[model samples]
Target chain A: MASRSMWRSLHYSAKRRVVSPAQYRCFSCSLRAQDQGKTDSEKMTHFGFTNVPESQKESLVGAVFSSVASSYDTMNDLMSLGIHRLWKDHFVRTLNPGSPLARRHNETEGQGWNILDIAGGTGDVAFRMLDHATNVNHDRQTRVTIADINPDMLAEGKKRSIATPYYNTGRLSFMEANAQTMPSIPDNSVDLYTVVFGIRNFTDKQAALNEAFRVLKPGGVFACMEFSKVNNDLFNAVYKRWSFSAIPLIGQVVAGDRDSYQYLVESIEKFPSQEEFRAMIHKAGFMIPGRGYEDLTGGIAAIHKGVKPLA
Target chain B: MGAVILARPGRSGVLSSLQKAATASSRTQCRQNHFHPPVQYRKQELPFRAAPTRSCRLYHSQFHPRAPTHEYTNSQTTILSAALEHIPSHGFTLEALTLGARDAGFLDVSVQLLPRGEFDLILFWLASRRGLLRAKVEENQFESLRSVSSVEAKTKLLILERLKMNQDIAHKWQDALALMSLPSNIPLSLSELHALSSDILTLAGDSAVDTAWYTNRLGVAAVYASAELVMTSQKPHADFAAIEAFVQRRFEDRTALAEKITGFKQYLGFVGSTAIGLGRSWGLKI
Candidate 1:
């Protein structure tokens, strides 16, 4: 019976309604409100570990990324011990963006395949995609657009990309836009939509996924790479220790920001699991086959993919 | 400031509407206003539940259902093709598995996807090649031999044809053989041998069901193992004709031994029966 009550509490916790603090004074008060079956307004969501007004989530996330934009690449290397490179490489190669479409657009040059990389700050995935499509596939008609909600992040990406041949060759471009609504990207225009290590920062993850579905051409792929729940208990213990204690210290030493790194770690934990996220993709009208998500590194990170159906 | 935020509420409205639509479309029970707490907070608050267990609710959730069996087979085929490129250079090492996983775009930590590590990958490669050999034999190569050849001749043809498939990876086969030679890997090696022999026998239409079944399989396995060793030891430019000759000689020796054993067994049975009859007809008992 004790276990039963604990499970009930957990179930409630998982679906904890984000009510304004004005409605419920404290955590206990919120529990009481739930017991009384009172429904609260949807004006609250989480900011790190704190429940803040929903209006503030976007800016809070923006502040966190802006604070770490310059040190983002370095921090990623330190945090994951440079395994992120292998992950990104695998991510791009899996997409193999132009292998199929390159044939259809052989007469049209490199403009046939369009890739929209959402929240791709600093052009990590974008550069890799361009390299794979150009060097590996020998197709020059693939193009990539790196979109980020934070201008600071976009600036950092633009600065880094200025040195590459793809910078101004009409093959690569950068845009500043919220993932939830990219009004500039026309419907059914993108062939591959990728969001890497960036979806957890979105205020409305489902809305972002919906936008992904809207922008993708029929039969296009939607791929995401993100930190996921570590399935192994012992590994999870070690990973948690490293993420909470060491990562923020590394951030302070390297990026001179502690709170932002703390926020990043917190956000990763708050993100949905592989199965839940796959459901979100499905809810957005994307078709997925068989579990939809593949766990990487013992579920420390995962890749989820879905295809827009051709009706 | 508040009015400015609310004045252009287009984005929020769009988001809310989209959320509603998502909730409606999702087949699973929609959690109203579900907010995931930060991991750190959850760990501190729910120590007992902090471990990442696959939840029963998740299992029952019909969110993203698993694909059918054939889709997994297709995906495995894709992974195998990517893995083949790395095997020739890296043998069957973890490095090869890593490269293959990367080429297949598996996310980090997905090395576990090939759970038994290098052994599993080696088995997969062997099985895949066996499949290809079967297709080649059935589709085009063995039609004429099937109608006119003896079982020994058919077995020789299949073994040689399969061995030829390894020519591309001859340099890497030395490393594979070394790994397979380890004491701990004996079981896996034997299993691989059994699979190969069974596949070859099936292709050759050798359907013996008596004690000959065991002998036929063992005979083919021994012949195939010896031929593999010989082929691997041969230099790249060494006479291909010599390997064929060696295989033919080995098959002939096995056939000759089998015939001699059969002849000896028949003679022993005849002598035992005559002795029994002589004892029954003996006048000493009268």
Candidate 2:
């Protein structure tokens, strides 16, 4: 039995590969300009602060992640002063991916808990979730799939996962997929769906939310953690100055890519406020109560969650 | 805005200042990761020590979730009303919508609600105002006008009422008219025109099933669109009396032309049927 278990672990790890961006096309081009029978110039969407053809947005965002893939984790630490780890920890705990509720549901369904972590490149959220599920809930059967649109980011995550015990235990995997549509992921399959600091990069956020609603089981949970609007004017002004002026300079010095970091900052500034985002989650047919989000650090970052109805 | 300028501060100085601000305002400092044994595991092991503040509101998970459709429409309405306030100064443009949403206490991302931005809001404003006009007509039981029996009189009254309704926005309507004339917005403008004409005919007690339905609606729509163009071409200081006179004259001219076309169509139908009857009697295929 021990030998069989070891063989199974190796087989699962061997199944993982870094998928290239070229191999991954957006599954549903419903909102593409060409699909709408319009010329590229006639229908434009925002690529960071610049307006570009809607079809070109995906590749532009992909190039950004590819350029910063290797140094991404270190840059994150330096940029946020390592406070990002605490936020990730809090996010995973709040999710409680394999807590008693998940276990109970898994028991009745006769399967291990499954989590689909979209755009979770570098395995930051995945590792934290695995640790929390294993250490806190004593649930070893919990599994996670880190899906990202960029292959270079996935390669970095794969390299980092080689030393972790979850690497070959059939507990972790990675896939190249777009948030707008994941055709390979079947309906009513996931126990939890999460996207950390990633949804704003999607060109069609409503379509992505609809896809999230489709892949989850009737009682699944949807959680998102991203930069949000700060309500206090004084703090907001200071934060804006710090973000717009300093972060890109740090990126230039540290990562040697100023434009990509500039794009990241612009994307954060363009994200919806906490309440508006909660309203969007509600629009996607999830069941959320009053003020269905929690703000962290005075709305600098927030965690919004909703549950799929059992019906 | 408090402009804080530091004289020739180095990169390290900026980083240090940011660090100091972060640490003083919040306990978000990084700590060493501690992986504990199973016996030492505790729910409170994480270093999330910040107390919940008033910046956010928390709700229990068990309460009923409200559908957001109503909220979405409410926000759009608020944004439209705010946009109207800026139209006089900036005209109908994306900048107006952006400033309007901000003035309505909405964040920058509120622009997402209107994917096409200014064009979408303009269409929304027109449709919403048309709805209000219909409501007003219904409330007065069609007695708000001087005469509802004759097509010319009725068209004149409807046009005058619409101009009156738009009196506050008269100066800005010229810009809106210009935007609606763009190639991309032409279809939307035409559809709104059709809807307005249909409403006016309905208030005149004209059933849409009549043979003259399409012709009547099209005629009225053209008259309305032209009258609007003429009204907007007037100087900003022009009185409503001039607009009312222009509308009456335009209505009289179009109404005569419409009556002539309707009579010609009836006469052609009579002659064509008579010809068909004669051809059938002569054993010819009709």
Which pairs clash in model 2?
Answer: none
Show where candidate 2 strays beyond 4 Å. A1-42, A100-109, B1-286
What residue pairs clash in candidate 1, if any at all?
Answer: A110-A140, A110-A141, A290-B66, A290-B67, A296-B108, A297-B108, A297-B109, A297-B110
In model 2 chain B, where is the ten-residue run with the lowest total lDDT?
Answer: B52-61
What's the CA RMSD of model 1 in angstroms?
A: 19.2
After superposing the true interface residues, what Cα RMSD does each candidate give?
Answer: 11.7, 16.9
Listing every candidate in turn, what is its Cα RMSD in Å to the true structure after a full C-alpha superposition? Answer: 19.2, 29.0
Which regions of candidate 1 deviate over 4 angstroms? Answer: A1-39, A43-45, A52-55, A97-112, A282-295, B1-254, B257-286
lDDT of 1 by residue, A1-311 (tens): 11111111112211223322232122333234335533367566775566655665776555444533343444566677877788778777766655422232333432546889888867878988888878876768788999988776677679879887798888898998989898898997887888888887778888899999998876577888888999999999999999899876875676554655666677677888887887788889875644567787888889888766655
Q: Residue A243 in model 1: shift from native, Å?
A: 0.9
